[model samples]
Target: MINYNNFIRALIIKNKDIVTAIVFMAIIAYVLPYYTVGGQGANAPSDGQSVGGGGAGGGGGGAGVTGVPIHVVQRTVFQRPYELLPCTQSVVELKKDLIPTTDFPSLVNETVSKFKVTVLNVYNTPDYKAMLLAEGDEKKVLQDPHFLPASATCGEMILELLPSLVPVTNIYDVANQVVSTYHVKVVDVYNMTDYKAIVILAEPDNAITKDSRFINYNQNNTLSSNYTGSGELDLSSGHIAAPAPVLKEETLPDSIKRTFTTEDLKGNAKSNFSKGVDADIAILDTGIDLNHPDLNVYRNVSFIPGGKTGDDDNGHGTHVAGIAAAKDNGKGVIGAAPGARLWSVKVCDKAGECKVSDMIKGIEYITQHADEIDVVNISVETPLSPALNRAISASVKAGVTYVVAAGNYGHDASTTSPASDPDVMTVSAIADSDGKCGGTGPALKAHNVTDDSFAHFSNFGPSVAIAAPGVDILSTYLKGGYAIDSGTSMAAPSVAGAAALIKAGDPNMSPEGVKKALLGTGSTPLTPCEGGPQGYFTGDPDQYKEPLLFRKLGAK
Candidate 1:
C-alpha cells in the first residue's frame, strides 16, 4: 500500500473520508493500474467510458483501467487580487453527503479523507487568495492561488489525464497498446503558459467551486523551474451548448436607431426586426464616451485596470462600440444587439494596440463569464499568437461566441491572431453603402478610397469568412455624435449580432454550427463580383449592385 503518511507532500489540500469519498478512495485504492498510453497517443478506453458524472469541464474516470487515460485539467495558480480565507475541513467533509458509495469504492473511501475539485467563479478575485488554512488544507480555494510552472506560464488545456486510467491490453485484447482512433485529442497543451501552477478550491462548501489561475512568477512573467505538466491529454463531454441571439438594427428604439436618410447599406448587419433593449455590448476597444447621448444610453461602459468610465481616450474603441450591441434605449443610433450585454475587456487602450497577452486575458474573462455576455466583438487584430488560438478555442469550449473582424486592407482577406482561428468566425468587410451618399453605396466590387475599383487599404484574402457592410457606415459615436466610417472593422458586428440571434434562437449550436447558420442562411442570388481586372471580380464600388451571398448554392 502507498504509505498513508509517506505519501508525497505534494498534496496541498487534505480530505475527510466519508462514505461516498470512501467509495472513490476504495476505487482508487483497488483500481489496478495497467499500462496506458499516458504520455502519448490516443486510443480511448474500450469500456468504462462514463459521462454526466457531474464534475470537470470535460471527462474523468472513477477507478478502473480503460484503453485511454482520465484527463484532468492542471491549474496554475496566478497572482489573484482576492484573499484566500481559512475554513473548517468540515466543508470538504460535507461533500461526502453528495457522493454515494455506489459512485466509488470502499477501501480508499473509508480512510481519513476530505477533498474535491475547485469551484469556477469564486476564487479568481482580489481578497480571496490571501487566506491561509488551519493546516493549509482547510483554506478555501477562493483564498488559494496557483502560479505558473517553472518552465512555462502559459499552458494549453489539452487533456488532464492519467494513462493508467485507460486499460489498453485488457480492452483491445491486442498485444499492441495503441488504438485505431486514438489521435483525436480534446486539446494540445505543450505550448500552454496558463496551467503551470497549483490547484486550489475557491470555497469552503465543497471543492467544485474553485478558481484556478496561473501563479505570479516571483519574477514578473517568469516561470517556475521544476514544472513540466502533462499537457497532451484530451477528453470530452460530447455535445456543446449553442450560441445566444442578439438584437437587430430595425428593432432598435426610434431614438437610437440610425435611419439612413437615403438608403445606406453600409453597416455590420441588417434586419427588419426591432433592436430589443439596448444590449450592453462590451467593446474592449480604445474606449467609449459615456456622455454621448446617441451612445450614452447604449454605452453600458466600464474600464479595465488603467482606464476610466466615459473615457474613450482613443477613438477606435468608441467607433467599434457603436457598431456592437449598444443600448437601443431611446438614444441616437441603435446598436446591433441593442439589449444584449456588453463589456470592455480592453486589450488596447491609449497605446492603440492590445498586447497578445492582454488579449488572451480578455478572452479568458469572457470564457469565464460567458453567461453574462451576448457577443464578444473583436475589431482589433493581432500578430499570430498560439496563445490566442488556445484562448479562442477555450472561449468556444466555454460557450462564448467570438466574432473577429477581418482586416480592412484591400491586400489580403485575413490578418492574424483571433481572425485566423476558424473557431472564431472571421468577419470581412464589403462596401455595401456609399461613403458619399446616405443611400446604399454604389454596387462595386471592392477597392480603396480611389475612383478605380480598388481593394481596401487593409489586408484581404481567403481568410475572409463572410463580408458585412463595411463602408461609410453611420452609427453611434462617442460624446453624442454619429459618424461615418469605412473599413472591414465596421462590418464585423453585424455578423456578431447575427450570431447572437442564432444563439438566442438555439443556444445549443456549436461554434462551427453557428458559422454554418450565418453562412448558410445568408441571402444569395447576388452576382459574385465585377471589379477585379479580368473576371475574378475585384472588390470595387463600381460593381456594387448585388452584395449578399450564401453558402449553400450548389450542394443540393
Candidate 2:
C-alpha cells in the first residue's frame, strides 16, 4: 500500500524549519487508514533554549528580532543515472540494460514493450531539489512491468520515475514474480503537462535492501526514505518549517496598540484613517476570516467569484490577514497595517498548497482588483511555473506593490514564488543575537541594529529585495486567538505594512517609486549577509547605514 503520511511529512515540512520536523516527531502518523509509518519521530521540548528536540532539524528562534541561527538539512539519493540515448535500444530487443554490462548485476523481466516514453522535470529552486514527474496508462505499463517499490502520494509533488528512464528490455528479469506488473502514471510536476512514463514496480516483501545506489545532484547530500528499513534509500530533504506553536502575546516595541491604547488611537491606525481607507492590502493567500470583530469592517470585498474573493479556509490566509489587517479591538491582537484594508483570493488549502488553477485565479484577482487594494502581501510559494509568472506580471502591470516572503528554506539566492517572480519586494527574517534570546518571554524588543542581521532560515539571493522581522513573530491564528510563529512568512508582511504606510502617505506613487523609497529609507544592519555563500546577502551595510529606508518610506 502507498504510504501517504511519510510523503506529506517528508515533502511539506521536508527541508524547512524544525517546527514541522518537531510536529513530525510529536504528531504520530495517523496510519492504519492509509498511512503506515509508526509514531516514533521527534518532538519539541517545552524547556527553554532547547530547540532541536525533534528528529534532526529545528528552526532557530532567537530571543530578540535579530539574525536567528538556523540549520538546513542535507538529502542525498543513491541511484543509477539514466542517460538519454545516443545509444538506442528497443523494447522488442528488451532483455538488457539491467546490470552494468561489465560484471554488473543480473537483468531479467518477461514483460517488454516500447522502452521509452516522455518526462517532466520540476524544480524547487529554493530547496535545490528537482523531481522527474510524469503520468501514463497503468494497464499498458504493467504489461511488461519491472519490479521495484510501488509508490503513492498525498499531493502532486512527485516525479514519475519509470516514464523518465528510457525502458530497457530485460530491466527486471531477476524478480521472483512480476505480480502482474501494473503500469501506473503520475502527473508531470515540472512541466505540468501530459508527459507519459511507464510504471513497473510492485510492493516489496521486506523494506530493506543493500543493492540500491544513491544519486546526488551535487554529490554531497544524503536522501532519507520511509520505505527503506535498512535506511539505504532516503528522501531528498531541505530545511526550515513549522515551529512549536505558542500562544502569541499582544505587545511589542513600536507596538501602536500595546503601550499606546485607545487614547493613542489619535495617530494610531485604529483611529486616524477613514473607516474603509485600508481596503487596499491585498491578502494573496488561501482566504481570510471576515466575521471576526476586529476585521468585520473590511468585509464583503471580492476580486472574482472564485476570483479575488476573501474566504479563509486555510489557516495561513487567516493568519496573514490578521497580521496585515486584523482589527485592534481589546479581544484579538493588533495588526501591522492596522489601518489597512484586506482583499482576498484563495490560493492554498489546509495543507498549505493551491492547485495551479486556483493560484492563477488569485493572481488574476489582484490584477483586476489592483485599484481596490494598496499593498499586496503574498506569503505563498511554489516552483516557478510559467502560468504563475503570467499572473505575477499581470499584478505588476496593474501597479500593485507586491511583497512576498524570501522563504524559510535556508540557502543563498533561493527566492520563493512571487518573491522571485520579479518586480516584487522580497523580505527576509532577522534574529536576536543579544543575550535576551528569549528573555522577558513574549513582550520583546526589536534590536534594530542587531536585527536586519541575516538569519540562517531566511533565503538570500540577488532577488531578495529587503529584510524584515520574520523570526518569532506574534500574529493571528485560525480558530481565534494569536500565536507565536516563525518563517519568511513573518517577514514579508512587516515590509508590506511599511509599504502601506508609505503608499498611504502618497496614494499616487508608482510601484518602482515605492520600492526605492522602502529600500532607500530602511537603515542597513551589518555586513554578515554580504559574505554569504552565493553572494546572496547585501554586499555592504554602508549604504543602509547612511540612508535609512524606513524614514524615507514611512515619511508622511
- Model 1 lDDT-worst window of ten: 1-10
Put down candidate 1 lDDT per residue, 1-556, tens digits, no spaces: 0100000000010121111121232233234342121100012222222211100000011122323232211122221112112211212122223233322223123222333333221111111111122332333322212211011011122222223333321321210111111211111122223222212222112211121112222222233332223222111122233321122222232111221211212242333223553333445555566565445333333334565553665445555666665554544455555545446555554434355566666677667677666567777654455677787888787767777765532334333555677677676554432222111122322122321122343344556566555544445544454444444456666667556656666666666787777666553334321111101113443322222322221121
- For each candidate, the alpha-carbon lDDT, in order, equals 0.38, 0.42
Model 2 lDDT tens row, 491-537: 67767766776777788887888888877655444411111110112
Identify the runs in model 1 with alpha carbons over 4 angstroms from their true place.
1-280, 295-305, 308-311, 327-331, 413-415, 434-455, 524-556
Q: Estimate the overall C-alpha local distance difference test score of candidate 2.
A: 0.42
- Provide the lDDT at 300 for model 1: 38
Backbone N/Cα/C clashes per model: 153, 75
Model 2 misplaced stretches (Cα beyond 4 Å): 1-279, 296-309, 413-415, 432-453, 526-556
Q: Residue 149 error for model 1, in Å?
A: 67
Worst 10 residues of 2 by lDDT: 1-10
